[model samples]
Each structure stands twice: as C-alpha cells, then as structure tokens.
Target: MEELKEELLSTDGKLDFAIGFKGTVAIGFQSPQSGYNLKVIRNTPTEQYKWGVFEGVPSVLEKYGRVHVINRTGSMLDNIIFYRVKLERAWFTNALLQELLNDASECVTLQGESLFFRHLIVQSKLIPLPVYLENSSQAESEAAIINLGHCIKNNMAANIFNKDLDARNYGVGVFGGVYLFDYDALEQFTEVKIRTNQNQFEGEEDIPEWFFEDGVIFLPEEIESGLRIPNRSLRQLFREVHGDLLQVDYYERIQDELGVGKVPSARVYPERYQIN
Candidate 1:
C-alpha cells in the first residue's frame, strides 16, 4: 500500500501532486471494487483553507473531479476540461476506495493513459450521499433539490463564473436531504453562454425541456447540430461512477422552467468559425 501511495504521489506524470487530503490512508485496495465508491465529491475552496467555504451552509458535496491529467505523462492543464480519473484514498473507506480504484483504472484505460494511472491517488475526506441517507420523503426530496441547486450555483458563482446548474450531479441523502458530488466539468467562468454561442435555436427551443430530459443545459445549436458533447461527456462520467442508480430524466424536467425562446447560436457556440 505504501508503494502504491508513493507511486500516486510521485511527480513524474501530468497529475499536479495530489492536491487534496494530504497524509491520508489508502483504503481503496482493501475491498471488492465497484462503481458506487468511485465518484469525486465537489467542494468550494475557502479563502483560509486550501478548499474552504462558509460554515453551516453545507457547501460540500460529491462530484466527479475533473480530469486535469488529460494525456497522462505527468502533464497538467491550467483550465477546466471535461474528464475524470480514478483514485483511492484512506478517507473513502475500504469499500468506497476499492470502487474508486477500479473506476479510475477503467477511466485511465479508456482514455489511453495507463502509465499515468500509477500516480492516481484516492485522496479526500468527502463522504458519499447513500452512505449519509436515513429516509426519503417529499419535503426531503424538495430540500435535496434546492440544496443541490444552491451548491451548484454557489460553485459556479465562485469558480466558473456561471449560473448554469446541472442538478443531475446532485442526490438526496438521509440527513442532508439533498447534496452535490461531482465537479469534473466545473468551469471558472460566469456563464456557460459566454464560452459557447451556438446554443441559440429557431422558434421556442425549450432549453428547460433539454434540462428535464437530458439533465443538462443544452444550447439550441447543440441539439440541432447533434453536437451533444457535454451531455455525452457527463453521461460517460456519471454512468461509470454511479452505474444505473441515478435518475437522469427527473432533473431534466426541472431545468425546463428557465424560460424558452429562439436564442442566437453564437451565444451558445461562440468559438465555431463555420455553421452548417
């Protein structure tokens, strides 16, 4: 285990030196791995702590940590990207850590970054939602959704500068009722609209419909051009981490209420040089 720990913390690859949970144990190797234990939890970094936020407001949740190590080879990215990796940390417990290890291995293999896999560390103390739940109810469900939205909005407002909330990344727990746990796709911009402008579509495109059915904020052009890259990316990440337990379509409906109309494609896909 110590050797494995050293391998993960080594600076020979694209990983940026195990940023969170320094000096933690590696419990992932002790259990039968599964997808339920592999997802990354999201938290807002505070001004005092390396990752801090306001107290008592419940700003922490589980999320798919963005894959900063794109090609492996010990390289790292300076901006947000859509990818996630597997890792094991003592903080995740034996069962959860094993799942994370297995999932990370699969992710690295799929992305063709097997060499860099050696450096992946399952680090952090953030807990999972299922492990925290006690019961289910309508009020609990509503609170969960609201809290999840707030968490997503808070993170977007603080880091990515966007208000586009992806509610699918959140789930309901027993005590907290609702919580968020993925962050691999988080951006540092104010709005997803600023990054891409092709989302605007003809007629009443129904952006909320896409959110309800897809659990994402789809731009008009993204649907028309069949370029659902963000959707595909997020689906891939969560499917691997949560298996089929996540209810995707339920949240898509919730997003449909953000208003609808023909929006300029440039507002959603700002970088496209040519339109079809």
Candidate 2:
C-alpha cells in the first residue's frame, strides 16, 4: 500500500505509467501476469468505502465479481479517495481497449480540484458508448448488449444496484461481452424503488413518470435511457437479445429472487476466456 501511495503521489496527476480507459475516473495497466488498475472518480462515501474494503473482504466483488463489472478497491491519498481496480482483460475489453489507443480515448478537464489529478485515469479499458456503437461490428455490439443484461440481472440478485447506466460506463469483455467497472454509482438494490408505470399523467404533462424520493441513488430509467445505442442495427440486436433490460420489471423479478436467496449464477469468466 505504501509503495502504491508513493507511486501515485509522485505521478502528480498524470497517468505516465498507466493505460487509460473511457471514464474520466479510472485508469489501468496490463499486468505481466494479471492484476488491476487505478481510478480517480468523483465519489461518495459509500463508493469510496466499497473500494477500500473490496480487496480485503472479497465480499462486494469476489463471489459476485463476474466479467460484467471489473473488480475494484478504494483507498485514500492526501485525504482524497483513490480506487485501485483490477484490469479488464476479458478478450473483448482488450480488443476495445486496443482500438481506443489511437483515436478513441478522450481526455476531460477538472475545474478546481487542484490536488486532484489533471488527467483522470481512463485505464479501466471501458470503451466510451459512442465509440463502441459507431465502430464495433454488429456481432460484437450484440454480445455486449446481452452480456450487459446478464450483468444487471445478476447484480440485482446479489443486491447491488449500479446507479449509473450510461453506455460509457460499460466495457466490452470476452466474446464482446459488456462489463461495467465504474463503482461511483453503485448501491444496495433494495434501497431504490422501480417506477415501471408512468401512465399516471393525464396527458403529456411533461412531469416525470418516474420518481425517486431518495436523491442519493440512480433510477431504473437511467439504465433504460442508456439502452439507446447509437447504431440502429446494433440497437436492434440488443433489443432482440436482451429486451428485458428495457423494462423495470425484469430487475424487480431478480430482486424478488434475492429476497428468497435465489441469487442467479453470474459466471466470472466467459467461455472464451476460461482456461481450457
């Protein structure tokens, strides 16, 4: 831990030695063997703690750390939170990450967080949604969509709700599967409610059909809204394969299973990445 802290402190907000991914918060590197990366996201206390404890307990991500979401652990440096995350290597993530090396990777500017790193780590290998939709082959996009469904359903079974459902938050894994590595928007599944019915309004009153009394979490619509992939053919393929993700009831059903401890199995590795 001390060594890692020293390295980060010296970097001075630059990913000089790290590979960047899509999200402004995370960064990564390919281990000579296999390992994780670094993330500098604007996070909440819970998100911060999730990282701080993930590596130690193996609870939040171990039993449930399938390919859908990369494993991560949080830490503090100079009073600011830093999350060290496992690298994304599920064949597809590598493919997408490599593609981004030239023209896909983008940099964002942070306004006032001076001690905060100027270049947020994008090394987690999560492809920006636009790039994935615009450049990925149809088969690849379809695979990511279906895999994302599995990721979400399985997460609900484990009682975790990933609040941010933006396409940029996901990465393509082995066999073009989708994996979400961003942990800033995660929370307990049961803490939020699903407003699947928006028919309460008399007309197009412009009022929100979905309402959340709690402001600390993300609504199901956030996930639903993110379903709109850029490519029509790719979006259609996603619809055909994982349409359930478009509806709130799908997650609700999985939550019911959790209530009875009927958590579904989320395979940690896709068949393509499994050791034969």
Candidate 3:
C-alpha cells in the first residue's frame, strides 16, 4: 500500500495519456506531489464514460479541490482498467456511508459463521463527482435513483457482486447522488460451474446430486468459484482493516437465488447455450 502511495505521489503534476480500450485514452497524473484530483479525459463506447462524472455540485468541489489527473491501472476480468489515486478531502457525509458502516459493523459483530464478504475502503473523500438532483422536492429519492442508474450504466452490478467494487470508484454528493470513477470492470460477467467429469471428481460426484436434490441446480458453483471470491491475501488484508465485517454472508442469498448446481448443456436455454 505504501508503494502505491509513493507511486501516486511521484506523479503529482504531470499529465500523460494512457491507452485504454481500442480507441480510448485515459489522461493520467504525471506526479503524485500535486495532491488529490484526477480525471479521465477521453473514452470510447460512445462517450458513456463521461457520464460517470457528476456535473455542478459545490460540495464535491469543497471536498476534492481540483481535477488533478487520472491514473490508469490494469484491467479486471471485465476488461475495465483499475486506477488508484489520492484526493484532497478526508471524508464526506451520506446516507449510503452510514448504511455501509452499519452493515460493516454488524458483520464484524456476527463473527464465527462461514460467510463470504468483500473488503472495500474509502481511501479519500475529497474528490467529488459532478452529480446533482434535479428535483429539489425529492432530493433523497432522486439521489437514490441516480446512484442506482449510474451503477447499472457502468456495469457496476457485476463488480459489486464480484467484490471488486471500490468506493473510490463511485461517490455520492449532497443532492447530486452517486458518480462512478474507474470504468475498468464495467460490463464484465463471471460465471461459476461445477466440474463433474474431471478425474478427481470421483468423490465429488455426489455433491452435484445433493445440490440437484435440494432444488439448487441453477447455481453454477460454490462460493469458492464465485465471481467475487476474494483472494486469501486480500481477505487477510480486509480482516486487518475492517475486522469480522469481511466475513459476512452477503452473497448467500444471491447464490441461493442463482441455485446450487450447473445446468446441463442439453437442458440450458437455447439462446444461452452455445453448441461447439
């Protein structure tokens, strides 16, 4: 983490162009000493990336002073590049923050259960996105709608479930609501499947039978292979930062909703199944 900080600081004032998807280029920070403020100047897929930036909000400016520079990291399974940077402000206020913190606290208190959770943190809150509510009478409702819309527009649903969703990757302002940063994981999907024919599957064959008998035959695989499975090292880091909050069973219901076993090729929906 220190190394990442150092790298960010070193590129403070400089601006450099980094290639992203086929025709896109991200404007990146040249040096870290310049302080928090970042921007992605260019993008492809019909300029959808620009909407991630909220427009006309004072609180956002009060928080993160300027649009310093953007930093492009690598791509995730979803093909969106990740970038880590610092911002001017230390914190911001929002209902989402309170809810998230409460959830985190509850997860920590309910330890000892076998559950799966993701660890994400607010590195900085000063850098605000340019989102605002058009309906003054319905500020809260507008905020929720915009935030949810932004999440869906940027393919964040996949990342959120996958546990790779970074708070810095999205932000909520006073009446402006949520704005998305980092477009890397947008539109990516990960599927889990049970391997039934492998040579090592002899003893595991019964697992599928049990899952099918239990009416969970739609689930592709166990939590181990889920799209958001946290790496052992990352999990350890989460435990250190957020304690038992990283051990909650947030995905259990979703997993159950998806079912427990893989659908046989012959039985899969014709539109979804591919023939080799």
Candidate 4:
C-alpha cells in the first residue's frame, strides 16, 4: 500500500511561503467568538522535513485511542499546509479536521502568502500541563503528574519514547489526561537499553560523566531534569508518585518485560537524527 498520497493540495498545503512567527502557539483571539486559531508551519525545508517525519505519526497515535494527538492535516493553494492541530488553543476539538473535508464550508481561506497549512494540526482540547499546574491545586498538580507517568508508560508500552521529554511537550487533554504532542524527538526502543546517568557527578572534567549506550538514550534521569516543574510542592508530589523514573530500576522492569515476551514490533531508531 502507498504510505503517502501525491494529490496536490488545494493550494495552501504546498507551503511555498513563510509564515510570521510573531506569536507563540498560545491562542488569543481579539473576540471571544473569533473563529478557531490556526498554527501554521513556516515554509522552510527544515520544518517541511520535520513535518514529513510526522506524516503517519497521527495514525499510530489514533490507535492508542485515549491518547491526545493531532487530528488532521492537508494542503491548500500556494502549497500552504495546515493541520487541524493548533499549537495553542483555549480548547482542542476535531472540528478543524472534519471541516477540511467539506468543500462547501470554507473552513479556511488563503488570503495571502503569509499563512500556510499544517498537516501537523491536532484535535486535542487539553492545555499545557505546566501552565495548568501553576494555577491549580496541589491535588490537581499531583494528578497531572501521576497522569503524566501513565502517559509515559502507555507510550513506552507501545514501544515509543519522546527523547525531548520536557513538560511543555506534553499537555493535559480535555479528558483530564496528560498526553504528549511534540514529535521532534520521538523514537523507538525495541532493543535499546535505556540510558542512565553514571554514579559520578560532573566536575572540572570536560566531558560529563553521564553514561551512554550504543543508540538509545536512558530517559529516566533526563525526565527528572527536563520534566521537573517550577513549583516545589508539585515537584515533591511527582517525586512521591514517580520518583522511580529517576532510578535505574524503573527502566529495569521495562527491560525485563521486553526480554521475557513483550512484542518487539518497534523499529530500532538511531540515537541521533541527521537532516540530509
């Protein structure tokens, strides 16, 4: 079966023009009733390559069912590309994706060259967890953190890992569950040994003493460092529920699971990705 369709986008899907980066993914419309905000991928070879890598990622995510992921993607005139997934929105919805299918609705219009389409758009109504945790109760924070652990476990069980495992890369979905949205560093580890920090600390030595394996990155230690939030209590709460992720034993169980009989269906990916 063919993996990608060669159909020409209505025009914007081609992304022949650059988009303005003046705004972050956060949604802020001048009116409360303003139509949905779009997150367009800048027209650049780098973004195109990155976006290309994500072509089938959403399909894989859809099978996970409960996981929040980008919803749909396609192109319009000018080769502009767009995704039903907005980088930032007050709420997540699948309307954008479905709208694209209705030729009569004019869900979006290509007014000029400054905007493009996003095949990387999503249908998640969840907000970023870190931002939510900042204004929420300790209970909420703990729940988010715990749910995050669940999210990680579920994804890993499916044989995938987010190398950039940062808190911002994840979001709390409309269902009150945390899910990952970023794919810039997604990878598989069907046989890769999880990387761990060496027992020694970094000192005057030029090279950091962290351990390294052939192609896999140990994610536990990095999670503690990268996913840690600013709130003291939230961090403490996460420690209570997921402190194991910072240790080797946490990964040992996964390693053992894979060794015994876990289906090794994932393709082994390189530790580093090279853009050619």
Highest lDDT against the true fold, candidate: 2
Name the regions of candidate 4 deviating beyond 4 angstroms: 1-40, 43-120, 191-193, 201-214, 263-276
lDDT (C-alpha, whole model) for all candidates: 0.30, 0.46, 0.29, 0.45
Q: After superposition, how far is residue 207 of candidate 4 from its true place, in Å?
A: 4.3
Model 3, runs deviating above 4 Å: 1-13, 16-27, 41-249, 252-276
Query: Per-residue lDDT tens digits of candidate 4, residues 1-276?
Result: 011111111211221111112212111112122211223222222321422333343443333332233221110001112344222121223343223223212223332322122343323234666777877777667777777776666666655666656687676644456766544455653555665545546663544333433555565666767775787776777778778767777666776776676642221221122144
| Model 3 weakest lDDT span, ten residues long | 71-80
Error of 3 at 23 (Å): 14
Return the TM-score for each candidate structure. 0.31, 0.54, 0.23, 0.54
Number of clashes recorded per candidate: 52, 14, 24, 32
Please write out the lDDT profile of model 3 over residues 1-276, one tens digit for every residue. 343345545654332211122212222222234333333322122253333443322322222222212211111111121233223221212332232234333221222331111222222222222222222334343333334333422331222222224343444433333444444333212232222323336566444443444211222223223212133543333335333122223233333433544221111111112376
Residues 1-276 of candidate 1 have per-residue lDDT tens digits of: 343335445523222212122211121221222112222221222232322222321222212234233221111111221233334332234443343345344323322322223233342223232222233354443343334334433333223312222343334333353333343444433223321343447575556433444222434222212311133433344335333213333223223322232111111111121287
lDDT tens digits by residue: candidate 2, 132-223: 65677765656566666766665565576676666655665434555655555566777667764445556665656344354433445445
